[model samples]
Target: MEEKATSATFKKETVQRLMSLHFKDEKTKVSNDALILISELLKLFIMEAAARSAKQAKTEENELVSIDHFEKILPQLLLDF
Candidate 1:
């Protein structure tokens, strides 16, 4: 959907801007490989969360994913930490 695409684009831009600011503050050179790896990791996390949300909604009476659902699930996810 157009909204998803727009949100993705915004997230990408926000990450890039944040990374730039982070590097500027640290004043330490970040290799291209490191940046790429971080970006990919973020994307992976976003996708995984989205997939889980969809799966959970489907299994739970076709309900839509909501912030409240995410909040309820997040504590369990942190058990590994």
Candidate 2:
């Protein structure tokens, strides 16, 4: 089956602003392709983290995923990053 293209979870302008803030003192400029890649990577990371969090909640017999679920996955998510 073919995969469908989905809209990115992050806004391009927002990502650009964040990048600027992160490299405020640096003279280097971020390229559009690099920005796009960063946004896509961020979306992928969020999706994976949420999925894992939901699984963890289910495994623990919780009906709803909560902050604790996300906290539990933070270390793993950071490692993935």
Candidate 3:
């Protein structure tokens, strides 16, 4: 079976604004391709973080995911990226 690709979850204007803010010192424009790439990265980062946090919660036999679960996985998650 072929794996399905995930769509970009963020909007172009949001990514564009973020890029502009990041480069506030030097005015610059983000290309359409780069915008899509960054939006995908942002989505992946959040998804991975949530997945890892949920697993952490399951490990401790918790039904609902919480900030503590997220905190536990944060260090390793940041390192992974």
Candidate 4:
């Protein structure tokens, strides 16, 4: 079966942004492998938080969230990233 296009695109974009922001910092040394590892490390938290935010937005408010919402939420888990 084919994957849904919209969700696949969204996931791709989200992953790209996550890599760029978290793994591509200029002052830090990270490689492609590290990017993959870090993404994997945080994937569950991101996915869960995204789902929760989506459900909350849907049932509780008229607003929807974008990948940027997750981007903002990620760094705050620690004082430094």
Candidate 5:
């Protein structure tokens, strides 16, 4: 089986809206490239967390990745951030 290519999952307009809300108090403008980069980075973060959580579940002989797996990795994830 061939693996499908995964594109960034976030909508640009939604991300732009979020950015606008984040900086609503200021006169700052978010650029298109910045929004794209932010979306890509968010995707990377989520992918990394899911992979790690899956690994944790597998290590414990569990078939399903649960919130416990995510909780186990949260501290390490925050450290990376």
Candidate 6:
């Protein structure tokens, strides 16, 4: 439980740097609210991907989750998203 909560925060500076890369202005300033929203969305995406991959592995009677499992579910997962 604690681990899940702890993973929610992303590096603010890295996020800001990535955002700047896409924009024309290198001096663009990002608001904390916008950064927070992006962070939450990123966290949600990672969690959902992990859960789906785990489910695929379990259905195959495998305890270990692997890239193959993720690849199998990737198509439908993208559609669902």
Checking candidate 1 for backbone clashes, the offending pairs are none
Candidate 3 CA-lDDT value:
0.88
- In terms of TM-score, how similar is model 2 to the real structure? 0.83
RMSD of 3: 2.4
What is the TM-score of each predicted model, taking all chains together?
Answer: 0.57, 0.83, 0.83, 0.33, 0.81, 0.77
Per-residue lDDT tens digits of candidate 2, residues 1-81?
565677756888888888888785778688889888999988888878988999989999999999999999889889978
lDDT of 3 by residue, 1-81 (tens): 565587648999988887887785665777899998999899989988988999999999999999999999999999999
Give the lowest summed-lDDT range of ten residues in model 3. Answer: 1-10
The lDDT values for all models are 0.62, 0.86, 0.88, 0.55, 0.88, 0.85
Roughly what TM-score does model 1 have, to 2 decimal places? Answer: 0.57
Pairs that collide, model 2: none
- Ten residues in a row with the worst lDDT in model 6? 1-10
Q: What would the per-residue lDDT of candidate 6 be over residues 1-81, giving only the tens digit for each residue?
A: 354455456888878787888998777789999998887877777788999999999999999999999999889878887
What lDDT tens digits, residue by residue, belong to model 1 across residues 5-45?
A: 32342245556667778564666556666666677777666
Please give, for residues 1-81, the per-residue lDDT of candidate 4 as tens digits: 453333222244455566567654556555666656656656645455776557655665548776655555555543333
Q: Which candidate is the best by lDDT?
A: 3
Q: Candidate 5: which pairs clash?
A: none
Instruction: Identify the superior model by lDDT, candidate 5 or candidate 6.
Output: 5
Error of 2 at 37 (Å): 0.2
Model 4 stretches with alpha carbons more than 4 Å out:
1-38, 66-81
- Error in Å for residue 75 of model 5: 1.5
